[model samples]
Target: MRAGRGLLAALALVLAAPGGLAAADPAAEARAAAESLRAAGNLLSGAEEAKDRVAALTETVRAYEAGLASLRAGLRRATIRERAIARGLEARRQELGQLLGVMLGMERTPEALLLLHPSGPVGTARAGMMLGTVTPALQAEAEILRAELEEIATLRALQEAAAGALADGLAGVQTARTALSQAVAERRELPRRFAASPDALKSLLENSDTLDSFAAGLARDSGQGPAEPGYALPPLPLPVNGTLLRGYGETDAAGISRPGVVLATRPLALVTAPAPATILYRGPLLDYGNVIVLEPAPGILMVFAGLAEVYGATGEVVPAGSPVGLMGGAAPDAAAFLKAATEGGGSSQPETLYIEVREGDTPVDPAGLFELDKD
Candidate 1:
């Protein structure tokens, strides 16, 4: 009987050990989701093209929304677990109190008094055995109480971390909302290439195979005569403040060589006319998103591509520093850019704008002409 009781006590102590009661980390998933959303926001803020801006902002918003959902779900799970822990802790406390009470009563009574009273030797012997069994059981209960206390502390910390994440998620949503609003507003103000008859222009575009062909056709149909000579290049301002991502003549991953300089800038960065110029074309062309071609001088053409939006219309002359368009800034999948940069052994190219200068049909090196230091 004593051996059986001792074995039970040992099992109880093992079950009450610290490792036995550990719960899974409640905040891990939420933390990961928050980090992903933050990375997406960083990429979005680095975008510099117009066609990419709305799409990027929309993705940022979606990520924020998803993060918020994850946070809420984490809070709910934490709340439920907290309630369960509280109930379990309370029950353990009550059990501990009962055991302590009995132990205290026994301690107060003298051993001599117990031996002299009632059933004498047999009663005292039985009491001694009971004390032995109770002592081990009491120790097991005390260990369980300690473990529960630690568990509660861990849960509270997880809850606090979750709350902080939730607050950050809310702030991200607001930032995304403001960015989206600005992008939409800019799109609404942009001048249309064919405001009088868009259908006629669409028909003309459908028949043209290349952007240059389209520009020539439009000019001929509009009755504009051949451009005159004697035009000189003006001092041009940098379209955006950024680092050169890729220079002319550099070949990219797909074996395609760049014909112009590609600048990587902050998301939604304003693109302005470098010199007083007339817009020759403004629209999507080939793989480029929104493109804007300008004539700063006769026979010298400046081309801006990979924009999120274009501001001026065909044949409209605009002064230097006039807002030509905006760079795309939406970071829909920042991870992809990061992965590509890592795998390609290159620096991250977040938002990029391609600028090409042409003399007739021949591409020119714009690096020699533009004073980029002023930006």
Candidate 2:
């Protein structure tokens, strides 16, 4: 019978685990909350930057179109060099015809005759000298043809180059425009999701209300400090290894910034519920994908995002180390995150785990409270 009572007590303890854990440092929690805000802010900033780039691309496309139009206009006009070459070639042909008349001993000899009988009468030194004299005129005609051909080639090359540049510029403009349009659409949608986010945040802040209210009762019973350390509380274990890609705090990405850490984790690593608590909400958020919120204390809310699955429902309590959801099945996983550390070599993995602690509805760094494994 005593053993049965002990088993019952154990079960109750398991059920009561939500209130039992979390003897952590408030400062660390604050930092975690702050980091969450920062991450959201960064994402919002990125979205704005994408919009700005779209504007720049639009301007560039306009400039490219203007340049293409100008090039087409220039191609229509004949250059002075081309006209000179045409005239020179015609004069050479006439001169050759006159020379042929002198050689053929006829009053009117065609230009073709001079070429055919370039040496006039062979087997004589005078024939060789006459061939040399006509050679210069023929060479001059060849030069004219070559010059005219070169002018046409230059114009064609410029036109081809300009066409390619315009094509590339237009493609860039279109891509940027699409991205900007997407940003605007998302910006409009996020407020509704974030509206509940503040409620969750409010719940977290209210957890501290116990500190002030229960402080009096606890002090009357047993003397206690005004603020107790949260370090002794259970640590929120990470489902996967990764670095803090974006710290908690106001960060910009899609359109608005919200509270949370953007962890660069293994692509598809499972994200589990940190502790046993009643799930307050579960659904898709604006920027956060497949989010789940849990209320551990009266006002202490834990928000989890970038999930593939939601194990528990709102008002359902979960245990510590519970598998809330697995990362990456059809969608990309937050587990596999890569940070850009170097310009050429690329980013390196961090040794420490990525976690954010929040207390009194504010963000704090999680590193201070937990004893991180160096290995």
Which is the leading candidate under TM-score? Answer: 1
**What lDDT is reached at residue 166 by model 1?**
50
Candidate 2 C-alpha lDDT tens digits along 1-375? 222233333333322222111212322232233333333333334544554433333333333323322322232232233344445545555654554344334223343453354454553456446656755654454344444445544533443344443344334334433443343233321112112344544444354343223223222222112224453346665544444565555464655443445565433344555565555556554435676665444444455666654544444555555445434433111121101100113233322222444443444454443333422
lDDT of 1 by residue, 251-318 (tens): 87788785688887645555777887777778897777898877776556788899897765676766
- TM-score of each model, in listed order: 0.42, 0.30
